[model samples]
Target: AQTVTQSQPEMSVQEAETVTLSCTYDTSESDYYLFWYKQPPSRQMILVIRQEAYKQQNATENRFSVNFQKAAKSFSLKISDSQLGDAAMYFCAYRSPGGTASKLTFGTGTRLQVTL
Candidate 1:
């Protein structure tokens, strides 16, 4: 089992700017998958990016990228070129690829506000 924490409950960013949402997790497992998901007004769970705990390199998806610190159990999302469409509730989640592959632990959430 893992516990994910999102320190910032809300963050505001100007249009076309950049913003970073922080997330940290506590888990005893050595192998797992960390993820960043976006839920907009429509309430759609969108996969922003993901990282493997054993991988040293961070995971990136276009303007969405993660700063994954395995040792520190930190996985943060950096949104570049922020847009109106980016405003949403972001969640950091993790899932062990073992027998509990069906389970996913998610953080509270971080409300991102993209402004003009």
Candidate 2:
């Protein structure tokens, strides 16, 4: 069984600044994937970034990057030059590489409040 944990329930960031959201997980499997999904008030889950367990280098997408510490089982998301549009509920998720019933295990979620 795998589980994701977001220690911070809520976080706030100023526009044009940067913020790092912390996340940790527990899993027995070595092969899997970690992800960060941003869901605005609209409730649409947007894939922010993903990192494979075997990849030594972290994953990055534009202003979004991940600090993936495989040994520590910690995967955190860093948002650069935060914008008002970035305000949303961020969720950390995990998915096994292969399984008969593959499913994404998500964290409790962190509400991101963006201020000017």
Candidate 3:
């Protein structure tokens, strides 16, 4: 069984600053996919970034990036130049690459608060 964990329940960062949200997962499968999803007050889960387990390079998208430590089963999200719009609940998720019916296992989200 695979499980994702987010130790931080909430986080705060000043505008234009940076923040890192920690996440870790336990999985026996060698091939899988990790993802970061953001849910704003609207409650819509939007994909932030994704990393393939077989890839060594960390995934990056604009101001969002991830530090994926495969050996440690850690996948942390880094938001650079954080903005007020970035305030949301961030969730780390995992999925097996095996079947089309595979479901995503998500972590307890970390709520991000951006201050001026």
Q: TM-score for every candidate vs. truth?
A: 0.96, 0.97, 0.97
Task: Residues 10-116, candidate 3: write the lDDT tens digits.
Answer: 99999999999999999999999999999999999999999999999999999999999999999999999999999999999999997673799999999999999
Candidate 1 stretches greater than 4 Å from native: none
Model 1 reaches what TM-score against the true structure?
A: 0.96
- Report the C-alpha displacement of residue 35, candidate 2, in angstroms: 0.6
Clashing pairs in 3: none
Candidate 3 ranges with C-alpha deviation above 4 Å: none
Which tens-of-lDDT digit does each residue in 48-99 have in candidate 2? 9999999999999999999999989999999999999999999999999976
- Give the C-alpha miss distance for residue 4 in model 2, angstroms: 0.5
Instruction: Give me candidate 3's TM-score against the actual structure.
Output: 0.97
- Native RMSD of candidate 3 (Å): 0.8
Give per-model CA RMSD.
0.9, 0.7, 0.8
Sequence-dependent TM-score of model 2 = 0.97
Better of 1 and 3 by TM-score: 3
Q: What's the lDDT for all of these models?
A: 0.92, 0.96, 0.97
